[model samples]
Target chain A: MNALSTTVGPPAMSRRGPVSTGPNIPSLVGSEPQQRGMGIARSRLVFVVILFCAAFFVMAARTVELSLKKAEPMQVTKQHVTVPPVQFTRADILDRNGEVLATNLGTSSLYAYPARIRDPEEAARKLVSVLPNLSEGHLIQKLSASKGYIRLQQRLSPRQKWAVNALGIPAFEFAPDEERIYPHGRLAVHALGAVNYKNEGISGAERYFERRLSDAASTNQALRLSIDSRVQYALADELESAMRVFQAIGAAGVVMDVNTGEVIAMVSLPDFDPNTTRGVSGNQRFNRVTQGVYELGSVFKTFTLAAALDDGVVDFSDGYDASLPMKVGGYTIRDDHPKGRYLTVPEIYAYSSNIGTARMALDLGTEQQQRYLSDFGLLRAPDIELVEVGAPLFPARWRKTSTVTISYGHGISVSPLALVTGIASMVNGGRLLPATLIRNSEGWRQGKRVIAPDTSRKIRQLMRMVVTKGTGGRADAVGYRVGGKTGTAEKASNGGYDRKALISSFVGVYPMDDPQYVVFALLDEPKGTKATYGFSSGGWVAAPVVKNVILRTAPLLGVAPKTEDEGLYKNVALRIEE
Target chain B: MRKIVTISAAIAAIMSGVMVLLLNIAVQEQASLNRTLAKQIHDDREAIRILSAEWNYLTTPRTLEDRSGQFLALMPLRAKQIVNTPATIPLRPRGQDVDTKGASSVVLSSADKPRKVKKNQRKGTAL
Candidate 1:
């Protein structure tokens, strides 16, 4: 055992000492060759370790690059397949009070493949017996057409569908479909808008939320608007009455929340029934509240006064010379009432004096006036949810004449919606929130401040003075404290203004101390009547409408009427002498 | 010992097979119940949708206003008619304050008050 151990130990120690010395012993072939093989194995092990590190380094670098890099935009190419179309069930539209304004009603429509029908005349006779509305001649002609398919009836009641199916006629089939029905008929036609027979939204709020309304997954959820149905009905009723009494060609009105800018009620008279909008006149479909642009005369005076005050150029007590008409660039601007005396700023607003307003605009100049109007969101199209929003028309060149005329609301024209939104901003603590049709949309928008709070208070006082003593006296609802400005503009004709045709409008804000709502009423081309003493001015035609609307809607909006003394706004009331 | 283990394993196999067959039957029955309940829920939802539409149609403001105008004498409540606080209500005069608490009915008019009987008259004879 000792001899074996001694021989193995000495050889092992010698081999370890020169293991890396490759092929050093030339004579001892077996032992040295084995050592050389061990050296090659050790070198291969180091090479493998280095290779592993290099691979790991590449992976780490790629991971870092991927983590820090921005992802590229994804593009999806369209691919078409000839499968049967899936009919969409639309979501219902509800008012803020959870009253359903629009809903999808299930219906069945009859169609026949003309080429496949065995007997067209016999089928027509059977169908007409079931559906008395369809003329037998028309049905026969449609069923026997050379076309591939023809529709016999668009909307059939369930009983009618069953009756036709009982006929057992070949090639005739009832296709299940849905119709968008506005239950209130013409009550909210302009705001709810109308949808095509295919259940596709074509205009108004329907067109605004078309994607959300048509989504199948959202069918159970109803889209709630900011409008209250009771208030909408009252506003529409009052405006319709005023239209009938005044003998106007058309009328438009809007009620809006001052703080959130949510439109409560919008009415455009001569509106058609949304249920059957086919063959309705284009004039009936024209949404005057949002789409029609008119020079809303003395209402623009409110802006002129507000802008002058906001710029620190004038105050309520500051007086302007109005003894005579002021001439600007070959055009003379005069007050319709023509109070031939120097008038204070409040008197100018209350009396709607064109001479005084134009003089103030001259002092403010063109640049500041344009800036103030633009800040009021009058320069561009109002960004409302409705697709029928109109772009305001302004003069291309802001010359002195344009400034003067625009001050009295002649040269520039804007939709009723833009006017109300601008006034809402002026009175609502000077915060300019864009008018919205969507409920709870205020969470996303932090309104931009356009005027100072002090200026807004002063403007409210002057507007109240207008209703109490000036041109808008008819709009003063006793306890409601209705404050507004009256505007009457001559409709523009071929290169001149027509005196006989006028656009009368009034803008009112109720509970003027802390303004909550803005009500605007406008009438187009109203004829003079004995009740108005042969006058079709804003004070006579439009102010009464504003008063009636405020009186009826204030209670529904949870606004309480105050006593006469309490109704007087707690601000510096402007005392003006006629 | 090997034979005993084989016998026990065979017995276990047969018992487990029977138990599995029983569990499968129970699961299938529960699945069928779930399917039936799901169908009932779907049918109820469809009925609710139709009923809601009909309710809206009946309660539309225009229809309600017209119907009320035709049949009922009720008008929209005026601002003057709405009294928010109890303090605004006029107080009754002395001797007119009736005990209304815990009473099912109260006499609103002087004519509706109960008549007092005379001392010499009998109650049944007056009728």
Candidate 2:
């Protein structure tokens, strides 16, 4: 490069007429130096322009390629930008007052990748040190397995998770998970039901509202139930105490709003806690209030008498002969404790006489009896927001014996919920509203009237008489005007009645003149007690429960109490036969 | 002139490179901060869920009832004890005006004793 520069430098100097060969251009003529400088500047400019053109050529070619590629669909950039996956949560269950009943608890589940673990024994030992419940030998064996992934534990509490994290064992990872928790324990287990490990609702309102509960958009909002937690506690406490006192195998009870058919509280005892449903017996999980079908005995007499009056077969002023056991077909119907004389219709109902009820049913015939029972929804499973409801058992081909026995609640079996709802229809101005578990401002459907308003009024009078003068006197909450019927049906077993094992139940309505609420309680196979004088009748075993329930819950339901001396229900009180 | 052009071009190249580096660093920082914020929000939501569940478990009816039984002296209100209206409250007798400043001053005689609750008091009665 130096030799070429020397040759070019002299030629350029000669062309510009330079006299001296000095290295410095300042010592030469001004015109000669200026011409030589111009030539050098032009050459440098051409070199820069060439370099710039090369860069432009490359940029332009790239631009052309990009533009041409736009026309080809296969050239589309399918960049798979991954995002963190969001998990769906189950909605919370709340009482009417916005108190939490059931909720989805977030937890961290631990899993192990055996193939990624450095030392199975060391990892298992460290893990067991933090989690004492985990078996060291089992964990070691599990961690040493060749499986790519293995679940080590599930539903770890936050503290437990922290302890496990502190261990810092390799190959152990925590996966976020959830568990369904029933906060109330066994208080409303039968109502809230339970969820499986997969977070799917298995029974009760949980199963009924599964779709709405798991919806991602609505999961945060709590699903409000009509149940008032305080009233539910009261009902459950009274029922459980009664069950204990009576030595019953199990018990069921319900408190329903007569006007709306909203079940304020429903309890089926011998219930298992939803939190630990493992190894729970079938009997413990049975929701007797809505699932078990029993012939509710004299509770059905309310309907028989109402049907008679509604069909114009009898009047409140009419009298029926209870002088002897009335024979119907091959069966003879007799009162539990007969009056031994003719009694008025109100008297017959107050005493809950099977003879009077069967006679009335004979007068109405089987078709009319079937129609009334069907209208009361006694012939079908109750349409409620629960999956455990039982379809009623009744004779498909109605006959004379069927009518007679059904009148006294022996020839048919229905759930306790069905009986309570039927009584609600008879007393709530005759409107048979569909019972519901959801709270509604407008209550349930008004429904068609099963009986005339006048008949309902007369039936209410008869019901109040039962509390005032007869078997249900034990259920008379002082100022609440507690009114209902005592049903002591011998449970049918082995194709025959088990007389010793009775289902003692009472369907009590408060403030009979107003009829705002209906409370029904039933005890299965309650043994005779010393306090009960060795009698396990409905009045002895179940009526006191109703009395206490009304006393405790009426105030919670906002039913005003009248002084007994106020003569509020005096007009409806029945005169007892001496 | 060539020297002036060459110096200006070098300065421009260095400036562009520094600007690109600074912008790239800023964008990367923003993205990292966004990821951190998203994780924080997710954790906060999970914490809230856990706390609410714990609150529910602590306030269950059974637990509350147990607490009440141990600590509270209040009993469930009875139907007869509930007064629907102010008029239903028996007025204080005239002779008991010694300390009428407070409604609690009145003392009841044996005759004013509460009537027994027949429904709850009766035991061993024939059914």
Candidate 3:
């Protein structure tokens, strides 16, 4: 209505002419003939209209093309159609620091459909080149057996897989299967335990937590153990070296958090790899820390003295006449570290005097001794996570002689774990915390108070004196104030204790003013070595290992190395030894 | 003229039906594509698990000890080599690598532990 409807002449000029007459007139006048002008204007109008129509057509076509586009056939690939759902049959076992200890790993096993396989001899010949372990004739015999399918190899290296694939045999195929694997093989074998070929947990933590680990719902999450692999490695490394150096039959060590009772590391040397556990000797698999029960020698004196002090039957200043061997019920009691004089309580403990300790036990009496030892968790098997825990053997009768002998860690047997757990109690403010393998085990809060705090302090002092003034001097790792006892026990043989073979052990607590960790190392029948001055005693063979373990694991546990009098952990100033 | 109008309407109806069918096909294709991507993600996760195992195997203590070549003298860190606290590290004397007065040596023994600041230590670091 405004312009297009009102104008029949060229719309462009008319639209412009109505608005600006001056400019339009000059252009109209200076232009060519009116007829030529009309013709050109009409042609231009048709061309512009056609151009608009063409552009509209193009847009319309594009709209249709986009809206009704044919879909490419669904590119459903064979792999997409056949992807297997990921299911971890078992939960991963991880160290406290979240390092992978044991997990299931899928390995490829090459197999051949014998019926479809053409030229079996050729295939075997080619396969043998890549896998030299499989003899060509044996492989051919198996391949040509007319069986449904025969295994060429159970485990194929990546290179072997590629090499076999390069040969392009259609009949040969790989079947994927998973096997339980321990990346740190043999490093934590005793603690982690073994698994069967069917992926069933057989021993150790594996057997201990089989249900939780194998359940589908819980398998997605990993089981974090109280164990620190670094600590485990160090303890194993040191313990193995000690065993080798001492020419020992076996060795065991445990490093535990004194307050939490979380076993940081448990090592038993002459260990086997959990990965390939076929033909492993039963003796090699025996977990000495948790399963093997030994008398554990004078390490028990700490318990006896702790018990006596706890019961208020003995004081630190009290003295015992250790100059003479005490005869109790036809049993003669003597001291390996014989100080033939009146020995104070500290002297009796530091010197590991069987006579003095026996006198203390006799003062407490048999009933009192048994009660304390039972309370200290020495009279029963350690309720640790492993299924292979040892049932402690002590005198069922609890005779007066038994009390005297058990006072110095004889006439009874306990696992290394039990001894360490008991020591953890004696040092950790008298709370007998439950030993645990699971990370962040909250069972310590429910710890039973086995002794008075004052008594625990006194026990720690005695233990400290053992290292500072007595047999455990070799266990003192400088800057970290170690306090411990050395126990060199005679292995029991026939009707009596063997005079030759011995179990030498040292159990240490660090930063004695405030004990945080307990390190225990024991060598079973470690023979005399030149380096140890031919003394196969705990002070000589096992104490150095305790020192090595402490030195290596202190920083890892964030226990700042301090001088004996450095910070809150001041020197354990015992009363002057008279 | 009536025939032309009817024919144009018929063409329009057929095109609309075809577009709807094509759109439906497109939706199906996209859904399948989504399934494919999901499958790919699952496969990637499995691959990651395998690769992580391999990585852990390679970085095991025994492996690292063996792989520690001549150029790298890999020895277990001793406790004495560790510095206890930052305060004992002795304020680099506000100077460059050049010799500076009142500057303490970099090496501090365990005995020099001025454990004044003990923060961010492993109280079961990041449960």
Angstrom error of the Cα, residue A174, model 2: value is: 0.6
Docking class of 1: incorrect
Q: All models: lDDT?
A: 0.83, 0.84, 0.84
1 or 3, greater by TM-score = 3
DockQ of 2: 0.27
Per-model TM-score versus the true fold: 0.78, 0.78, 0.79
- CAPRI-style quality class for the chain A–B interface of candidate 3: incorrect
Off by over 4 Å in 2: A1-88, A564-578, B1-48, B88-127
Across all candidates, what is each one's fraction of true contacts kept?
0.29, 0.55, 0.39
- Residues A1-578 of candidate 3 have per-residue lDDT tens digits of 13443354444546555544554654654466855865776788889879988997998999899789986777658435444556778989999988899988777789888888778899899888878888999988877867687777776766778888998888889988777888888988988998997889989999999999999898879999999988898899899999988889999999999888899999998999998999999998999999999999899999999888988887866879999988999988888877688988888888889999988998998888888888989888887888999999987787888888889999999999999999999999999987889887553454799999988888887788888888899998988889999999999999788878999999999989889899999999999977777899999999999999899888888888865653321233343253
DockQ (Cα-based) for each candidate: 0.14, 0.27, 0.21
Worst 10 residues of 2 chain A by lDDT: A76-85
Candidate 2 — which pairs collide?
none
Q: What is the lDDT for A491 in model 1?
A: 94
Q: Encode model 1's per-residue lDDT on B23-127: one tens digit a residue.
A: 999868876776666666666666666777788778877788899999999987766887767677665322233656556543333333334435574433211
Error of 3 at A237 (Å): 0.8
